[model samples]
Target: MSGTLVVGASHAGIQLATALREIGDREPVTVVGAESLAPYQRPPLSKAFLHGSADTASLAFRTPAFYAEREITVLTGERVVDVSPTGATTDRGRHLAFDRLALTVGARVRMLRVPGAGLAGVHHLRDVADATRLRRALTGATSVVVIGGGFIGLEVAAAARALGRPVTVVEAADRLIPRAVAPVVSEFYRQAHERRGTAVRLGAAVTAVTGERGRATGVLLADGGHLPADVVVVGIGIVPRTELAEQLGLSCDRGIVVDRCARTSAPGVVAAGDCTVVGADRLRFESVQHATAQARAGAAALLGREEPVTEVPWFWSDQHDLKLQIAGLSAGHDDIVVRGNPDSERFSVLYYRDGALLAIDAVNATADYLTVRKALATGATIPAEHARRADRRLKEMLVASLDA
Candidate 1:
């Protein structure tokens, strides 16, 4: 008998199984995944993996022996076609009955609908296979045109530039990473890329990918301009893989709606990962921290334990030599404070609302980030005046606040 059956053996799914085992719940746990490779890290796909510095062997989160010792059954390269309350059936006509179910079905990359988007040289980096194919195509490529100035696009551009290839980043929005960072931070990254010889085209839209003989050659812009390219990578965004949840009549909006405990509307079925809209805010987090946090909560809930998930939202991105780390959510922020120096490529942008810290984006400031992350989590307020002082250390201000 299947104790717990998890769909989509991603970070969240694997974390769920791991958490369950750590809690000493010795039950049959089966993890089903479509990818043949055991659960691997997705963040490295854009940076180290795409740059060909890291291999697939290092990408895996757990070794085969580890999973075997944990008594977890991992079924790779199998797709769960249908899931009911009692059991799920795979595409290969295999049906497995489960007492409890966990759906960690992650997100899929949004493909461009433009003309020639399906051409050979056009690519999207979502999984290992996608990165593998794109990395292969980047070999000996002279020019790369990246669509969408999001994290993935910028990372790929950095990787290609590192390989001595010319890169042009096209963003339909007025700035890069508009959905996440502030305009000031956006300009900083733009200049950072430009310093490395990357041409960033803002407020530009790609009408179509121009191809010759079924291979992408260039991109035609909405403004009637054409950029030459041997490779094109699209990092537009992603859509949650909620097909299985929705099929089972589970509530779904932008993603499968789950509570703080990662409990879905359907009984005995919990969900975590990029596929869940969590909490009362209905906010969908696409970061690895959010996925693993929700997975831990879901695992505790499944085990009838009282583990409340109250993790602060955070994310990071690696572009060229910069390591940008963000802590907390920046919503309704009324003021901004800059720490360190942006000119030197080491700084932090602190977002605040009504004297309370909202979020922080620290670049090349690991010490400041560690302090600021704790401050944000504890609702510690730092005077905006002290926060803006480039001369004073951020860590000192936090210590003073706690002492007071």
Candidate 2:
């Protein structure tokens, strides 16, 4: 059947619905979004929008009229609580029967289970409302203590520092963004934030949040030390919303397991976004790019319009004036080549495994960023030594074939 049902109306879900329609699937397209608001870009929720640099209208992925015009039915403010083998059930009591089901339910903010974590000033950044509340909290906060030294926390710290607020970051890891970046990249971030006067407490596990009158005032470290603050933002990570997928008995491990075509274990069921593990490479990403790509690909799978999914995984982060772009996945890269001058704040790091170019991490280098992205997309065979030097133009080297 050409009819498609996509759940979780984030970027992935919305993208699937649109793609299904675009690909000549004429049947009804139902998109279930947990958030009442339309699908929006989440990366800005921690940076530009929190800093009053962007409006809610600007973050919208699609207009309400666009969905209506496309004949796409979007069930907003409805949570698909259960997904049986045959269909999905919503919170407001609606049974959705589907010919093909797509799970694009992204992820949710993971809260720390520490003492006094439920304090009034303790905020978590994930959705638009959370960012809005945090922005309001910033007005009266003289000091801000952020837990988790990930991108969101650091971005929030930057915004608070810009407002002349004393900011402190408490991370259990020895380095910031330990899970995401290499040691050198983490060091670069440490130097950058420290230069901006952000107090970083590395290897500090927050045991409790000290509060007065149900409001967070400070955080007690595992060593019984306290870092005083008027506001707290938690950005540890996210957990995939897999309950519905699990209940439906779809093969789920970490995320709903799907093929390169985005089909779940069960027939007539597909999965996408952060909620599904798609690809022969066993990869799952919560980023906007992955979500959108997976959704479109899943739509194709549902319509039986098989096109080889050749999209490279990509992610980006906006920190201060630096725009970091990563092309391809670097899960098991053994060799990393530092390209461009780090001193110039415009560089690209090439990650390779067994001589195959795996990923490129670009920081403010627009030209090299495009070059490496193209190289990875085209499966170019480039040698490791040549990728490391700033003077060696990768484009020229590629033209000569990577053997040189």
Distance (Å) between predicted and true CA of 286, model 1? Answer: 1.4
Residue lDDT tens for model 1, 1-404: 66999998999999999999998889899999988888899999999998889999999999999999999999998999998899899988889899999999999999899999999899999999999988988887989999999999999999999988999999999999998988889999999999999999999989999989888899999999999998999999999989999889999998999998999998789999998897668888889998999999999989887676788888999999999999888878999998877889999999888877778899998887887888877867567778877778887787435336
Which lDDT values do the candidates have, in the order given? 0.90, 0.83
Instruction: List candidate 2 segments past 4 Å from native.
Output: 279-281, 399-404
Residue 293 in model 1: shift from native, Å? 1.1
Count residue pairs with overlapping backbones in model 1.
0
Error of model 2, residue 23, in angstroms:
0.6
What is the Cα-based TM-score of model 2? 0.95
Q: Indicate the residue-level lDDT of 202 in model 1.
A: 99
Q: After superposition, how far is residue 94 of candidate 2 from its true place, in Å?
A: 2.2
